[model samples]
Target: MDNMFVLGIMVVGAFLIQSALGFFQIKHFGNEYNELKAEGRVAIGKRAGKLTSGTIIMFLLDDEGVIVRGKKLQGTTILARFKPYDKFKGKYIGAITAEDSEMIAEIKITRNTVMNAVNNYKMFINGEAIPEKGSPFAELVKKIKNI
Candidate 1:
């Protein structure tokens, strides 16, 4: 009975420590984000990938799709949920300020079936096919290109 009581105390202690850590993380990053917003900077895109050590790397892209400005934060995680944007390296995504650089909140363009079809068509035609004007896919492509 004594051993079980001790185990319960230890478990509760661990949970409390975890809760404190999470609270601190939010306080720190939230302040940083608010400061950036006040300055009128936006984040265009976010990319997170693996680092050599246990540390994960995250980058914030500006409007021109450049990784010039971002808050660099280090966190311990075995694997990051973010996947690398492989479609095009250095693609032009329009003017994102530093305020848009929150690690937890990012706009991700999910590829749907229509997007896949368009990509497959592009590949088949050797990348030379004009999407029909006023088509939904064409509008989507335009928006992405403008981003």
Candidate 2:
């Protein structure tokens, strides 16, 4: 009983730490996002790797649709935090070719994520509803809703 009690306490303590760290990480992301939003239009893209590291990319755009700045966050843990990115700065959005994407992206996943951001910006300019890409569970829920 004593051992089990100690284990339970440890688990609870770990959970609390994780939750607190996650909250702070989210706050950091929000502050960065809001800062960019204040400067200009912001386009965001995300890749969720269920078992692997995930990535999120945000681009700050000018009125002419040029990328003014960028930020990226990637990791599997809450420790992941947004960092300044400038690869696409001064470049126009929605005009990256496959070759360009390959050259610019540090990895394949980042390449796809950047493309998603470009598409997001394009759709927003056209006044189209942003299409969502969700988990398998979310798809199942949508299917059930339609029925």
Candidate 3:
């Protein structure tokens, strides 16, 4: 086989594998989000990681802004799965304060992400902008534009 042809084949294989993995990741998020939605409104926060692991948090909130359940996923690889994040469960989103210790479990979600969730929920209640994905690409673009 020609060397260039072999390289092309390898690249295609990699792309296909990546796409399949991406699909699985989306499905995983969808399944969990739907489950949480079934219970109550879901508030989400995200932290995009460049060299480190990215983090995403989903909180199931009651109509009164109390957290009923939570999930967090943090990883650099496709194998990362959402884990139960019960730290703030049963706490009111408004009541969770800076005084609360920054305790995160094995998922490695940062306190900043939790604060983002709080801000997002507040914005939601106030009918402001909806929470959006903190994509690294968009951040990079913003940085470049600011420069």
Off by over 4 Å in 3: 102-109, 131-138
Candidate 3 per-residue lDDT over residues 41-132, each given as its tens digit: 99888877778887889999988988888999988988789999888988999776555764444334467778778888888888898746
Candidate with top TM-score is: 3
Residues 32-113 of candidate 1 have per-residue lDDT tens digits of: 6675556543332222322422221223334433443344343344222323332322332232222333312432322122
Error of 1 at 67 (Å): 6.7
RMSD of each: 15.3, 2.9, 2.4
Q: List TM-scores for all candidates, in order.
A: 0.40, 0.84, 0.86
**Which window of 10 residues has the lowest lDDT sum in candidate 3?**
101-110
Pairs of colliding residues, candidate 3: none
Ranking by TM-score: 3, 2, 1
Q: Which one is best on lDDT?
A: 2
